[model samples]
Target: MRTTTRMLALFAVPALTVTGCGLFTDETTEKMTDVANSFADALNADDPAAAGAVTTDPPRAADTIGTLYEGLGKDAHFEVTGVDKDAGTFTLDATWKFGKDGHNEWKYTTTGKVDDTGDGWKVGWDAATVAPGLDAGPLTYSAVYPEASRVLASDGELMTQQVVTVVNVSPGADLAAVANLIGPISPGITAPSLQSDLTAVQGKPITAITLRETDIAPIETQLAALANVTLSPQTRLLTVEKELASPTLAGLAQLWQSDADAAAGWAVRAQTAQGTQRLAGRDPEPTTDIRTTLDLGWQRAAESALAPITQPATIVAIAPSTGNVVAMAQNSAADTQGPIALTGLYPPGSTFKTVTVSAALQAGTVTPDSIVACPGSANIEGRVIPNDNNFELGNVPLHTAFARSCNTTMGRLAVDLPPEALTDAAAQLGLGIDYVTPGLTTVTGSVPAADTPALRVEEGIGQGKVTASPFGMAMVAASLAHGSAPNPTLVAGQPGTPDRTPPALPATIADQVKTMMRETITDGTATQIRDIPGLLGKTGTAEFIDDTHAHGWFVGISGDLAFAVFVHDANSSGPAVEAAGRMLRAR
Candidate 1:
């Protein structure tokens, strides 16, 4: 869901909930950083032994980071970033500066130790990323059926989501032959020996590399050196970096130097913190930013902590001032072309009232205190649109009706307004159109394509053939919050400059809507949002064709970030409110 707002839409099957937070921390913050730096120094110094010397106890002998230094020396440089040091461990934040634009920068984190060995300070690579506890069994690629998945990232994290290369090893190539075959592929591993360090598959020693689970790709020729290496199949562990020494490692590196898979693997993992977990075999991860504007600590923590209680709710967060997507995650099991953000056409529910208000204001139809009757449901041009907030509540001010999400009020406002006014306002906001710019795409979330009174009434209430993407909703929030139309943007590197979006409505109208949205939490359906300190928000209860309990929705802005969320196909609006509260409560 963190891929794109729609990509993680959780429409039919609800709740792939995620959490948010600051940075990250652990036991070994600084020492890990030191070992990573020391390893970089040794690699620059062309001293594999010196690099191996700094490894901690459960040493990482043959993992990802370990192989980074296997064969090559003085070929790659390092760029260090923010580092955090904990109790006995440390995290080295750096990027592998290899080649000239051949690769931008491979980010990675190396975890190391400085446990008081009673000998000053000792540091080295952790064993998790390395998987040094090998069976001495040779590692090999399954050439008979070599397959790889590629992972692509729009955020430039260097991950792949496509196949790059394939290897067809001999039926039973020995470790030496395997090593020799891949010697020219990368600069990480060494050729195999005639001796017995490699494993045999069908008397062939075949193994496989899979980056499917994490959006990375796997290739045979790219991993020719590691083609036949096989640790116990039961072991489910992976690390962010390596601190190992092996001829096989050299072979993998050799392949990595030229071949795509090995090189990309090293590249993506290079800048991440060391992590170990079970990885499954499948198509490579989709090419998208794994390193979101999202705080890594929040993402990892959400996956770790929320896996227990939260289902899958599509979460889209952005920096309102700059429109940078901090995080996007969709927890649905799969895409069903259901009510996905950009595609599906569903009722926008009361959320669209802001648009209705805009239309009315633009047409000089209503002001904030314009008195409107709330008869629960109003028949606008022979079509009935009823209020879910059925408290009769006589006639009320325009702003009050919006904060309360009164369907009747908006429906009447829509019926009376010129259709062109409403449609124009929607178009100005970027709807009923293709929004394929660079970072985000607009899927015509059912903007009023034509002019029918029923449709118009529904449009006013965010219902009927009216739908929208979270990104679109967030834009509305940002527009209202800033009193200016701001295009949503992903934080690729930094906001060098931004394209200007003309105001979607008159400046005063946007300001008035902003007030109503703020009043929503203060005196409306979204009272739950008031729990947070400074908040402005709107809650929605969309009515689709097939289900009950209107799909809950809420969009809010705080600090410098603007976020929009939908607890699609849920049991009640409570979850959506909770999601909004989750964002609001965060300082």
Candidate 2:
């Protein structure tokens, strides 16, 4: 409760009797009470260090204005106009001040953590609650805005996180964020995706998503934009109702057909993708409990922040804290684009060195001071690799090799760790497995072969079958950030019950890997961001998927968030390295 000066009357004005033991004055109380007030005096004098010496307890992130009150009440500036004692109690009357305009003016009710110091009054953890709203302040971190959130489901149970969408219902949330969140809520929105499946004429695709059967909630405004969006009846048919367009609505059928083409397209006859056990199409699946851990603000930020110059772009941000996906977007006129960055199994480009390097160090095969050549290209395993600067040169330290992103050097060292050890390391970081995440779009990069130690060398360098989603790679970067496995996401609520992922690699190992990443940023391929504070990452450009498109990737951390981005089938003709570098730096 709020123990304040005003509320003090309620506690003492004869209605209630004190319940604690009889008051005893101790020397400790007198000493502390004086100390608390002294700390307050220090704060008033703008001496933070002096105030800290007395009241060392940290304050809550939510105590907006109470910062004035440190160990005791450093900022508790209520005027002590006078002190009164009667019937074993003490009362003080005073006004407090805050702000240059002297905007804050109020009386405070308080209870002191008092002890009789062989002397008189002393202070304990005692304090009073100031009046509500009287201490008006800016909001701290809160999740209560009208933002869009994503939730995932399987077997009618949510599998991800409570990715609440705050702005989806409001005006101006990113279109990409709304679309991703739309992954779950269609049943209530009348299955606009299905309404979209009808064989009618054309215009822009109209679709809706909502909560289970009911009038549209304000959240469905965008879905409502599609005239075809509507909820299903008790049967949960999730039907698509079209006006049975005349030949007059020339383009309606084309629009209707577009949604039907999707794997998630609403179908009137078949009950398949959300499959069954006893039967094929007859099994029932409900859209109840679907959710995701997607954060609305970051999702919107990721979407609006990306702008591609005639080339396709993919971004995947996951909460390394839980593998909660924050954002996934394709910057293209994508009627048929796939989520390749997270699902496409392309060579890790140069970023694979982050993992390979870890494997090497864990094996005790390399130390920080070990030396290797700063070569442009080198041949091993009947294959050739070239460095970006193409200047195969003199011996350099292992740290320099990482900073330079030397493929030849990493390829040689990848063989240092047993192939199985390297593969296990990848799995520990949440790679080489079918994504436990929702959405049919998840693609597990091909796992490294256990039988071939020789192949592990390239795999260690993020080549071979080491393909990963941008999210997965981002996970790799985050793992380096935390020195452990990172769980990430882009949705809200439980997609299903959470499973304890195996813990990250040993902390010491994670630490070394992180140091290597930092060196890379300081003097390697990632050096483009060398001066940017708190940036640690790896850059890769590999010719793997097909001869036509060489993939370019950047994975790193800035502040608390981690990101994995890709330039798919990036036309090698342009400055892919420079472009990818610029984009990665922006993040």
Q: Which candidate is the best by lDDT?
A: 1
Q: Candidates' TM-scores?
A: 0.51, 0.49
Tens-digit lDDT track of model 2 for 1-587 = 56697688876764444332223233333444465455445545656555444432224312422443331233235322222232322333434433234333344454333344454443322223222221232212111112111122211222222212222232232344444446554423322433343324234433333243333355456554633334332322121211111110112222222222221211112122444211111112222322444444554455444454455666666555555555555554321355455555667677777777776777787876798766777776666766665766568888888877777788778765665876777766656645453342455455566457557656766767677766567777766666665544333442312244554587777777777777767876665556677666777776764544577777776656667767766643133334434544454
TM-score of candidate 2 on Cα atoms, chains taken together:
0.49
What stretches of model 1 exceed 4 Å from their correct place?
1-312, 332-345, 437-444, 491-504, 546-549
Among all windows of 10 consecutive residues in model 1, the one with the lowest summed lDDT is 137-146
Cα lDDT of model 1 by residue, 1-587, tens digit = 47676655755234422221112233245445665566557655656467657655423442433454442223455433444453554544444434445333334455444554655345544543222221222111110111322211233332222322323343344545545545444433344432232334334543322332222223233344454443221212122212111111222222222233322322122222344222212222222222224443333322232122254454455565665555554443313333244344445566777778887888887789999888877778787776675666688898888888888888888877776666667655544434433333335455754377777777777877777876567666666665655554433453322233444467787778778888988998788668675677777888776645577677776656566666666545567667656544443
Best by TM-score: 1
Q: Could you tell me the lDDT of residue 526 within candidate 2?
A: 60
For model 2, state the Cα shift of residue 378 in Å.
Answer: 2.1
Give stretches of model 2 more than 4 Å off. Answer: 1-292, 333-335, 438-441, 490-503, 545-548, 571-587
